[model samples]
Every structure is written in structure tokens, then in C-alpha cells.
Target: MDFVEQERMAHGIPSQGKITITVDEYSSNPTQAFTHYNINQSRFQPPHVHMVDPIPYDTPKPAGHTRFVCVSDTHSRTDGIQMPYGDILLHTGDFTELGLPTEVKKFNDWLGTLPYEYKIVIAGNHELTFDKDFIAELVKQDYYRFPSVSKLKPEDFDNVQSLLTNCIYVQDSEVTVKGFQIYGTPWCTIESIPSRCITALYDNCSAQDRKKLRRVVNTAQRITQTNLPSIDSVYTSRCLRQAANIIEDPSHPGHSLFSPLPSGRKSLCLKARTTTLKDSFYPAVIRLLNGPCIH
Candidate 1:
């Protein structure tokens, strides 16, 4: 028996090397959950076929079926949450409330205790320590601003990543397991900008500020493009907050409602926040993927 694995984006562009598996016959009943197959490999083949010592095959067989249990936005509270049994555990991000190293470590410890065979995690806006550039920009604007609680420095990046050792961390990347392709990103739209400056920015800001603003906008556009590919599903930290009026009446507001941030001067910090949420806003991200967008 031969098993070939080919990874491709939704549009048919191959993204990874093809994995060919040759195995003996094995049977398992399929369940209502994701599909799973059992392969009893009688021989181990190297990247190139060669006569080598037979390798031990201790790999555990699937637990009857492939099941996925997903949760998101835990915000560092995991004790009371009851997790269901599944072959794969998916956490969509916001594992930490403040992105603090301590918080991250705590979440990681909790994740390590889960019974799932495969675990996947992604960062959320609250996980600021993961994105050094964004945090540095925020610090420059104002150390006292929102999401600056831990005073995280660029040096903490590796430390944070190291703490989450038990699960696969994904950021604007894709992973394949059991022939299923899963893509995850922590990006989300920042709080909405006030309607007042939506049109005034080009007229009043200084050249430097304008340049900064443009860069922010451009970065957001690029991030949005990352989601344009077709995929089985998307896992993201940011989720669309249903329009309030739409939910209330279904006719009062014809379009989605994005609440604006409290009125304030447009500062670099504000720009950074705006940039994160601007192009890749929840609605826009969902529209581009054309699939179920999990938060």
C-alpha cells in the first residue's frame, strides 16, 4: 500500500513536499468525526530507497476515529472549562489575557495536561509578546497605552515560544495532519477608528505621520491577502462580532456594524491598532476565505 501526501492551497498551488507512505493493510471503522485511517507499516523507507536497519514501529494507532475539539478566547481561564475527548485539540488563541510570560506558561502547562493526541495553538492580539515588531511600535507610541501591561521586550519572543512546547504554534502558516490541511493566523482587525478622521487624515497629518499611517495601511492590506487562499477552514483569534442591530431587528441595520473606539486623538498607538484591524477585519477576512472562519 502507498500513501501520498500532497499539500496545496485552496487554489491548487502546492505548498509542501509530497509524502509517500507504503504500508500494509489495516482496517478501522469510520465515525461521524473527521476521517482517520490505520496503516500498519511493515517496512520503513528512507527519503531515498536504500537497505537500512529496520526501524521500530511504535507509533500509536488512531483511537477508532479522528475527532477535533476546538475552543477559543479562553483569556487564560481554563480550570472550569470541560474539554471533550478528541483526537485533535484546537485552540484558536487569546490563551493569555495580557500576553504575559507567566500567563503563557500557565496556559502551556494546562495544554500539556490535555488528553488529545494532537494540539494546535495560534496567537491572539492579547498575545502581544509573540509579535515583537508590533509591541515595539506600541512601546514607542506609549508604554502606558492599551495592551502594554507586561512591558514585553523583543528578547522575550523565544522565551514565550519555548514555553508552549507541547502544541504546534501557527502564525500565518498551514499544517497538515492525517491528510487534513489546517491554516491558522492570529491577526484580527483592531478597534474601529472614529468616523471623524476617516477623511481628515490625508489633509492634516505631518509627512512622517502620514508615511507611518500609509505603512500601517499597506501592512494591513498584505495581511488581508494572506487569507485569500482557499482552505478547508481558517482558525483565527479574531472573530466577527455580529452586528448588534442586525441581531436585534434583522432589518434596522442593512449592513454590519463595527463599533468605533472611544473618541480620542489619533496617535501612533491608535494607528497601530487601526492597522491591525483595518484590512483584515473579521467580515473582510470571512468574505475572502469563503469558508467557515473559526475564531
Candidate 2:
């Protein structure tokens, strides 16, 4: 493929209005099959790209007509509590525990049965196994297991595919729905490998395993890298020593900003509040849009 064709392929774009190519009937090439099918049997519709009218910087806030319900980190606890009804149901992350086949089936079953018109879901750290590549492979193979060469179970892959069929799974991407630009990320602080049974869960750093994990880490870092530095890094650098000294002068109110901990620690004050680990936004949206409560 030339540069233009390679660029198109990189973005999964169709070249020109139409393109034609011939291939042998016995060809087992997946790309060839897709291209061939697209050339004849498939009809491609150009995306609808609408331009929104620009609003003045000082324009007044629009009337609060639309309600948005956000939920996150459900981790496969659907039936434990009733969901609040809303125009949109947003489940932010950790849709299932371990991202297992059975868990996904139950999660999808519950999500599909919801009364909300729009249901959006995102994956979280616990769903480490449910990456886009894994999901795509599962879908392509009709949720079957890899042959003896790979140990990934059939049930696991199939379940992921099944769940994806009904719900929108956002990876390192964004979707526009009802004037909102929704971006999703499934990342969290890395946990120490607690168990060795599932190699995916922990770092079993053999030469091959190191290569695999390094690739995964590098890809993830590039995908989520941002131009801005964190507040701590910007403030504590040696290059900012003069500025830091000025800011931390005795007369400065910021002098105590980085002071050592007090001799006696204070006890944490506990409040009686409903704590939600996942889908925290879903219920809030339901309460706002579908009235204070869905149940």
C-alpha cells in the first residue's frame, strides 16, 4: 500500500467514492475478503458532519431543558439497588467484575432491559482484559476460544462480544450524543499482582511476557499522554526554586502549604452517606432527569 492507502487504512477509511479489486475465490485473507465484500455487496454511507452555530463568548447560558444522568464503576452490581430513570443513562466504568463472560451477560441483560432511551457505558481498571483488540477478535471469531496455542477460554471471549453487541463500548475515543462530547478512559492506579493463577492479572515478567506488557504500557501511555504537567511537578522543580522560596516566605500565607505533618493526627469524621463504587453518575442522572428517584 502507498502512503495515501496506508493512511486511509490506518484510520479505517474508505478510499474515494468507490474502488474495485479482484481476488481469487480460495483466498483466506481477511482484509481481501472485507475489501471484496465492500466493493460489491456493501453500501457505505458518508458520515453526517453537521456544523453547530457558533455561540458568542459572552452569550447567556442556555435554559436547562435537557437532563443528563451519569453513572460509573458499577462493577456488576445491577440488582443491588434500583436505577434512577433518566433520558440518558451513563455508566462510566467497571461495568463488570473481572470482565468475565457470565458477568458481562448479566450486565448486558440488565442494561438492555432498562427504561432509558440512551444507555452509554465505559470500562474501568478492573476490566483490564476487555481491550478493543480483544473485543474485536472475539467478535470476529464469534466468541470462540483460540486453538491449543492460546489459553484464553471460549466463554470469556464470547461473553465480551455478547455484551458489546447491545451497549456502546468506548475505548480511547469520544462520542457526541445530544450536544455532549463524551470521552471515556479505562485506567487506574496499578495494583500489585495478588494472584498468580491468571497471568494477565499480574506481571509474570518472562522475556516474552516483558515484551508483551511493555508494548501494552507504551501504547497506553501514548494514548493518554497530555501536554499539561501536574500541579505538583510544576511547583516542586529546582528551576522554580526562587519562585518557591518567594511563595513559601514566612509572611506568605502559602508558607504552610508544604509544612510537615502536625504532631497529632486528627480522627477522620465519618458521615452517613450512600457510597457508590461504580456507576456513580447513573443514579445522579436518573434523579435529575427522571425525577428524584427511579424506583
Candidate 3:
């Protein structure tokens, strides 16, 4: 039915269009996309987890199979919170804490009363008015010190991703409905600055990767400056607590460890944290799409 088709990542080139997998064909087949997606970052192998014991949410669908309802940081709160049944919802963004176009039209009218046939949204780091270069560097700072970003006034957050229009809004794009090949990006990677840093809401970054996400958001406001490297000792709530999730091993079939993460990796290696999280994260709006290794 021609649900949706988008692939916009200009200046960095990433579009084999719809049935995509471009990153120079995932770097000329990186180990067949790392053994077809059981990609582990060897600290000496070891990866094959199969521990799934938790189910129930009106469970009743194994027929045509295809249920994905993953949500994340529902900032504007989804009101009552009772949305289980799924056939693809996957909204991995901050439904708006400030990307406000009346909160993206009330999150596109609550994603049009969700009966998900396909939603697939993305863009996090608190969607700050869709990062028009971080609202042009927070309107050159000092407006009574960002008071919730200068009590806003540019048409109360223009466009705001065209008010969602009821779904599919990926950035750095790539989407396909039923046959699924969904790729999304809110660009972030500073495992000590290899490059890239666009906290989504579009700007195809290149002010030298927005100055390495403002020097890792100003080195988490200093720590008596000491041995710092390996990506600024990772901050931003330890990059969302070293976010990692790779599942799909329902009693292990020909198991690629239940594949799902195969979207041309380029950055995000993060691995440094002992204790940190008292409001810091935007450590370039950390987002780590999972598919962590297992067998």
C-alpha cells in the first residue's frame, strides 16, 4: 500500500534507498555483517545468551508473527498506559519534552489511537525542538540562562517533524513497512571522537560534528581534570547505562541469535562507567540501538 519510504542522510551518503543496506554494502560485507548479526565485539569471544522468561500482556499471537511494540522515554506521558498488542510500533524517542509543536501535536494524537500496523519513529536526546543546530546553539546562550530555553517563541517550535502525521519519522532515514527493513538514526558517537554527532531533529551535522557534541557537552562540567581519554571517560548517564539489548532466541533455531540489529554500524563503542548520573546525558542524546551478541 506504499506505507512509507524515506532515506535522507545527505553529505555522508547512506542510501541504497528502500530495500537498503548501504554503508558501502556494510563495509563490503563485514564478516557477513558479523556472522549475520550475532555481532560481538570480542574481548575474547563469549556471546550466546538465551534467557527469556517473562511473558503475558494479553499474549495471543503466534500466527502470522510480527509483534514489536518497543517504547522509550514517553516524556509527555502516554496518559493511561495500556497498549500491548503489536505489529510494529517501535517508537524510540522522547515523544517530546521540548520538541514541542504542541508536543508534536500531542504525539500525533497519541499516534492516532494506536492499532499499530507500523509506527517506527526515532529521535531522542529529548528531541529539543528538533535540533536546528541545537536551536542555533540555544539562541546564543544567556537568555536569563536558558530558562527552559528562553520561554520559547519561534512559532512555538516550528514544524516539529511535521507533527508526526500519525507515525514513521526516522532521521538519517530508511524505512519499509511489512517486509521490514527499518533503519533509523539520531546520530551519536564519541567513544572519544571518531566523528559524527547530530542529536537528531535534523541538521546533517558538519560543524566538525557540532564540535564533537560541544566537547562532549563540556566535559561533564569538569572533574578536577585528570586522566581523561577513551572517550572522555564516558558520560551522559554512562551513555544510557551502556545501553545494550540483543534478543531473539526462542529455543534457538538456526539461530543468528535471533537477529534484528543489522543497520550499518559506524560508531558507538562506549564502555566506561563506574558511577555517573545526576542529569548529564545529552551526552549527545545517547542512543544505542541494540542487537547485542549471543551465540
What is the number of backbone collisions in each predicted candidate, taken in the order shown? 2, 13, 4
Tell me the TM-score of each prediction against the true structure. 0.48, 0.40, 0.27
* Backbone clash pairs in model 3 (N, Cα, C under 3 Å; residues 3+ apart or in different chains), count: 4
Q: Candidate order by TM-score, highest to lowest?
A: 1, 2, 3
User: What's the best-to-worst order under lDDT?
Assistant: 3, 1, 2
Which residue ranges in model 1 land beyond 4 Å of their true spot? 1-64, 145-150, 189-214, 222-295
Q: Pick the candidate with the highest TM-score.
A: 1
lDDT of 2 by residue, 83-171 (tens): 65456677887777657666777888888787766777787756635764654554555543433213455455644644665566676
Over 117-138, each residue of candidate 3 has an lDDT whose tens digit, in order, gives 8888898877887877777567
Question: lDDT per prediction?
Answer: 0.55, 0.49, 0.56
Candidate 2: residue 18 lDDT (0-100): 36
The C-alpha stretches of model 2 lying farther than 4 A from their native spots are 1-64, 132-155, 188-295
Winner on TM-score between 1 and 2 is: 1
Q: Tell me the alpha-carbon RMSD of every candidate.
A: 16.8, 20.7, 21.4
Report the lDDT of model 3 for residue 275: 22
The weakest ten consecutive residues by lDDT in model 3 span 193-202
Clash tally for model 2 = 13
1-295 per-residue lDDT for model 1 (tens digits): 1122221232255446565555323212111011112121344332334353432333343433465677889998999777776678889988987687788899999998988888999887678778777666775666655545535566765457778898998888999876668899886541122111333233334568656755554565475442221111111211222333233564555333433324422111112245434334334433333343333
